[model samples]
Target: MRDMTGLEWFKSSYSGNDGPECVEVALTAEHIHIRDSKTADGDRLTVSADTWTSFLSHAVPRV
Candidate 1:
């Protein structure tokens, strides 16, 4: 795992302000970092930019 201390994490706008279920994401040149917003110091998942794009293609709904 890379040092995430200086990473800028962001949560989805769709996530409710009152919820603990929010997910946070940070992007680096080599990978995309995903972690639980409620547990910033916990384990995180890292994927390549291509993998992240592929996941989003299937995960996001098209208009």
Candidate 2:
């Protein structure tokens, strides 16, 4: 894994109201990284930016 220490991570806007469970996301040139906000050093997941975009397109409800 490359040095992602310089990457900026932010909480999901959908996370809502500082709950026990939260998710954080960071982006790279080609990939998006996700991790549990409660455990900064815990397990994380990485996916392609394309895949993340596709996921959001499908997962988000349409108005």
User: Top TM-score: which candidate number?
Assistant: 1
**Which stretches of model 2 miss by more than 4 angstroms?**
1-4, 14-17
lDDT of 2 by residue, 1-63 (tens): 123488688876777765869888888899998988788788889999999999999999989
> What is candidate 1's lDDT per residue for 1-63, written digit by digit as tens?
234488888888898889999899999899999999888899999999999999999999998
TM-score of each: 0.86, 0.79
**Segments in model 1 whose C-alpha atoms lie over 4 Å from true places:** 1-4
Give, for candidate 2, the lowest lDDT window spanning 10 residues: 1-10
- Residue-pair clashes per prediction, in order, are 0, 0
**C-alpha lDDT (0 to 100) for residue 8 of candidate 1:** 85
lDDT of each: 0.88, 0.83
